[model samples]
Target: MYAILGEDKSDVATLKVILKRLIGDDSIKIKTKGYNGCAELLRKGAKQITAFSKLGLAIFVVCYDSDGKDPAKRYSDVVSKIIKPTGLKNTICVVIPVQELEAWILADIQSVTNVFSSWKPKEINNPESIDNPKEYLEKLSRDCNRRPRYNHATHNEKIAPYLDLDKLKCKCPSFLPLVTLAENHDAHVAK
Candidate 1:
């Protein structure tokens, strides 16, 4: 079992779908448990969530956007307040790229083209550094052969299944933790 506590529905949904694919188990329990935002999770809900400690092979993953703030500080916040308080082992915190979580989707350009067909993406060597990723994604998504609504609820879940995690990890530095978590998840499953 893996639990994703994050900002919104679309963002969490994207992570859930990607993790499900990464584990190659459609039946894997990747619990979203409603769309809990980071503020709420850092507050009351963090203590209330017990699955991390109780469930075997569990990983409690938190996803939050950098918001142009210092990721180290944000990471420390989660560590001190959430992870430390719960004393949960195998917790992974990933600071999403500039501005918002949508930038993660753009990390894998090939995947976006695969879903949208002939969707041309500009060369982005460092997707994490891209300013205003949501706006960029929205513009690129509009140009797709088949225009799909670009958002957490609409496009994120749709694109995640087709996402090439390897390619994504290569392009976005922040995505490395996700790869690490997937490896850890696989190791736990094998055990």
Candidate 2:
């Protein structure tokens, strides 16, 4: 079994879809848990990892948003604060989405348009560089006069399943960790 941890419900929800797509195996059981937010995740992650490990879940995928902070700092913090302390660094995959998880959402404009046909979002050249990607998406939805605007908590899950994994991997460098994790896990399972 594998496990996934993230800062919020939206992150967990969206990540679940992304992982399933990348792994291409619905039969693979993936357990997931979401903390309140970044602060809560950071404060409680180590304990959670230990609990999941005890439960026999070997591989862990932890998702954290950079939230305008340096991506390297975010990655290091997860490694130091969670993985290292738990002595499970090798089994843990840390995915720090630059700025916010919304950046990945923006990586595939076609997916967004497919979900919200009325809002034709412009292709973002550097989605990872956006300081507040969620706000950018919300503003774009409002600007296009799309009804029921973009709410990360709901729309993220909806758009995620349809996203082109190739596009996301190419556009968001931080997203590669999850791809690698999925690939490694798939190979292990195949063996």
Candidate 3:
């Protein structure tokens, strides 16, 4: 079981599902509440770790967009806040994608092309370099088939599925941590 803490629900809807697959649990892994925002997530985390951690929970995965901040710095800052309250080191993994979650979406050229015909994925070799990924996504979404009114409520989920995990993991340095977390989670479950 696990808890998904993120800056917002839109940021992690697909991620939680992908992570479950990534974790490689042999049997169905029951998770605590599906997902919660970081502020609320932090409070929930503080509660579960202190009061209910023994309830088959193995890890707390925190996902946050860098939003112009340094990914490493953002990751460390978040870790400092949660570690003392949760007393979890290995069990708490922070996923900070540079620029924003959209950066990861753009990392996979195939996925980007699947959604938008106008985007040149090969040109986006470094997603982190883009100043405003969300804007680019919106523009590209308009260029998608029939300009299908792209918004977080409608299209965010569509992006992750098309995203090639191998490509995303290899191209985005920030995304590698997510893969590492999955590997570690699998090891812990194996034990």
Candidate 4:
């Protein structure tokens, strides 16, 4: 079994979906340690690591965007504070900075404004300008091809773009390796 540790519920959900799609099994247990923060999770994850090590289960830690901090730095911190002291070599850590998880959930207008203060919506000089912001964002997302620039738009921006999640999955540094590992495991079992 693999363990996924992250700051948001959406990351857990997204990872679970991806794992299920790749491995053809939804039985992989995915637990969310905390919401929007990792300090406490890191502490509890330490205990979980020891237990998993005893069971000899392969353990992997996944974290995302420590804001502007380097992923290696964050991984080192988690290892030192949680994994290293536990003396577990079966465990490995993967971190994604400027995490896609955040973008997935906060793919809306108000959320975008909260992150990028300079954002503004393009003024639609029509009666439809009164449409629900969420609906507007959704339509805009579909029309703009889901680019990060759309979702991360400021309040002043009228349209939020869409990102090609499929394309992104392929490009994510951590994604291919995980998929390959799962595929190799399946292949070995078949042999």
Candidate 5:
């Protein structure tokens, strides 16, 4: 069994799709837990990790948005503040999405188009580089005159199933941890 932890419901909701696609199996028993937000995740993450570890969860995929902070530094913080203290660093994958979780959605323009046909995203060569991808997505939805402009909480999970995993991995560097975790799990299962 594997568990995923994210800053909010939307993140874990979207990740459930992504990780299932990566693993290519519906019976793997992937569970998700979400915190209120980044601050809450940071403050309470360690305890959650420790508790989950004690429960014998095989792996934990923890996600936090960088929120325009340095991705590497945020990754280090999650490692130090959450995983390291649990002494289960090997069982945890820390994914710090650059700027926000929406960046991963923006990485696949086709996915956005699949969700909203009217949404014509301006060429986003590097999604992770966008200053505020969540706001940018909302602007795109609004400019296209879509009813109920892109909301992170709703649209992220909506678009995730349509996302091209290859495109996301190529465009969003910080997304690697989740991919690595999936790959490692696959290897372990194969053996």
Candidate 6:
């Protein structure tokens, strides 16, 4: 079983969609715990570790938009204060700063906009004026591909400029374990 702790319901839904696509809905159990912010999620995640450990479950914590803070420091804090003390390694934490679970979905921007309709910015008031942030982003992505130099910024740059890319880069390696684990689990069931 896998449990995902996120900043909000939307983040959890996005993660659930990805997890279902990658590992199959039946093979993994997904649950959402809301937190005011990354720090709070870390706090709750610590407690979750104990309960999950008892159930012999694997837990994955994914947080977004860490507000320019060092993800490694945050992760280490959780591990040292919560996970390690509990002696749990089956649990893995992956943080995606600036946008949470939305970053992982393979869908184009428009798809994302549809999922987060309520949160769409009113600045794009014109019904046809790139009203959907996701759609706007998808267009930008397509344009970037057409003109390579137009890639002055990466996807994260366009969607979430506030993120500390340096910190995100440092913690990205942590996600490999979960990705590999999910892939392996999928392969086993397929066979």
Q: Give the candidate number with the greatest lDDT.
A: 2
Which pairs, if any, clash in model 3?
Answer: none
Off by over 4 Å in 6: 62-64, 98-107, 113-178, 186-191
Expressed as tens digits, the lDDT of each residue in 1-191 for candidate 3 is 66656766667676765676566553645343423455665455456554445665666677767789777777766766655767755477678878877777777745655655554445467777887787887766576544555566456666666677776777788877778878876466675
| CA RMSD of all predictions | 2.8, 1.6, 3.4, 10.8, 1.9, 11.2
Tell me how far the alpha carbon of residue 90 in candidate 6 is from the true structure, in angstroms, after superposition.
Answer: 1.8
Pairs that collide in candidate 2 are none
The candidate scoring highest on TM-score is 2
- Which should have the higher TM-score, number 1 or number 6? 1
Q: Which regions of candidate 1 fall more than 4 Å away from where they truly are?
A: 34-36, 51-57, 90-98, 142-148
Residue-wise C-alpha lDDT for candidate 1, range 2-65, written one tens digit per residue: 7877767777788888877766778988777544666876784366456545655366677776
lDDT of 6 by residue, 42-70 (tens): 66666765776577566565554433356
Model 6 scores a TM of: 0.54
Supply every candidate's count of residue pairs whose N, Cα or C atoms clash at under 3 angstroms: 1, 0, 0, 19, 0, 3
State each model's CA lDDT, in order: 0.69, 0.85, 0.66, 0.50, 0.81, 0.48
For residues 141-167, write the lDDT of model 4, one tens digit per residue. 557554444432232222222322343
Cα lDDT tens digits, model 5, 1-191, are 68888889889988988988888876788778899988888888888877776777768888988898887888888887787777764467788888988888778866777777766666567888888888988877777788667788888888988888898889888888888888888665654
Residue-level lDDT tens digits of model 2 in 1-191: 78889999889888988898888887778888899998899888888889988998788889998888788999999988988889764478899998999999878866887788877766777888777989988888888788878888889999988888888889999999999988887565664
Among all windows of 10 consecutive residues in model 1, the one with the lowest summed lDDT is 48-57
What is the lDDT for 113 in model 1?
63
